[model samples]
Target: MKLSPRMQFLVRNGLKGFLWLTVLLAAYFLFREVVITHKPDAWVERFYARPMIIYLIYCFSEFFFGLIPPELFMIWAINKGDTWHYLFNLSLFAGISYLMGYINFLIGGFFYKNETFTNLKRRLLKDSASQVKKYGIFLIIVAALTPLPWSGVSLLVGSAGYPSKRFLKYALFRLLRFAVYGYIVYQTHQI
Candidate 1:
C-alpha cells in the first residue's frame, strides 16, 4: 500500500529524529568514555552544584527557538544516576518547555500586527509558515515530536490565528516526546 503524503512526511521526519538521537547518544558515549573518564565526579559535581543556572539556560533555550536540544538535559540528569530525581527533572524540563511554547504563542498573537514581529515572522519562518498553513496542526505535532523549532512553529500557529484549544490539545504531544526521549536516554546511560 502506498503511503499518503502526510504519512510519508511523518515517516521521513521520524527517521530523521531517530537518526539524530542515535548520533547524540554516540557522541555522549564518546565524550563520557574519553574525556569524562579523567574527571567524572568533578563534571557531575558542577552540574549538580548550579541547578538553577542550568534550568535557566534550559528555559531561555526553550523560549528562544530551542537553542539547545532537550536530550542534553536528559543526559545531564542521567549523569546523576538518581532515577526518581531524574524523572522529576525531566517533568520539570518538559513543563518549562511547554510553558515557553505557550508564551511564544501568546506573544505571536499579541504582536502579529507589529512591523518588527512581521519581519521576524517573515525571516525566521519563511518556509515554516507555508508548511504550517499547509499541514495545519499536524505540523505542530511534527515540531513537538521532532527536532523542529517548537517555539517558532507555535509562534506561527498563533499568528496565523489557529484556535488556542486545538493548539493546546496537539501540543500535549510535546510531553510524550520528552517522556520517550528521557526513557531512551536513561536506558542508553545504563550501557
Candidate 2:
C-alpha cells in the first residue's frame, strides 16, 4: 500500500533520527575505546560535576533550534550510574525543552505583527511555515516527536495564530520523545 505524503514525511524523518542516533553512539564508543586511556568515569565526572552549567547549555540549545542533540545529555545522565539520577535528569531536560518551546510560542505571538519579526520568521522558517500551513497540527506532532526544530515549529504555530490550548496539548508529545529516546540511550549505554 502506498503511504500518504504525511506518512512518508514522518517515515523519512524517523529514519533520519534513528540514523543520527546510531552514528552518535558509534562515534562516542569509538572515541572512548581508541582515545581515552583513562576510565570514562573520570571524564564523565568532570562534566557531571557542573550539572547546572550543563543544564543551562541544554536550555539554550533547546530554545534555539535544538542546537545540541538531547541524546548526548541522556548519555551523560546514564554515565552517573544512578537510575534515579538519570530519570531525574531526563525529566528536567524534557521539562526545560517543553518550557522553551512554550516561551518561543509566546514570543511569536507577542511579535505577531512586527515587520522585523515577520521578516525574520519568513527567513528562518520559510519552508516550515508552509509545512505548518499545510499539515497544521500534524506538523507540530512530527516536530515534537522527531528531530525537527521543535522551537521553530512552535513559533510558526503561534505566529500563524493557531490555538494556544491545542498547541500545548499536542506539544506534550515532546515528553514522550524524551522518554523513548532517553530509554534507548540508556539501554545502549548499558551495552
> Candidate 1 on 1-191: residue-level lDDT in tens?
99987778777877786787678668878987898898978887877678888899999999999988898888877776588989999999999989999988887777776788779878887776566566756777888998788898898788865678888999999999999989888887874
How high is the CA lDDT of each candidate model? 0.83, 0.82
Measured against the true structure, the TM-scores of the candidates, in listed sequence, are 0.82, 0.80
Candidate 2 per-residue lDDT, tens place, 1-191, comes to 99998888777777776676677668878877876646866776678789888888899899998888787788878976588889999999999989999999887777767788778887886776567666757767878887778888787788876778888998999999999999888877784
Candidate with top TM-score is 1
Point out the worst 10-residue segment of candidate 2 by lDDT. Answer: 128-137
Candidate 2 Cα outliers beyond 4 Å, as residue runs: 35-42, 115-130
Clashing pairs in 2: none
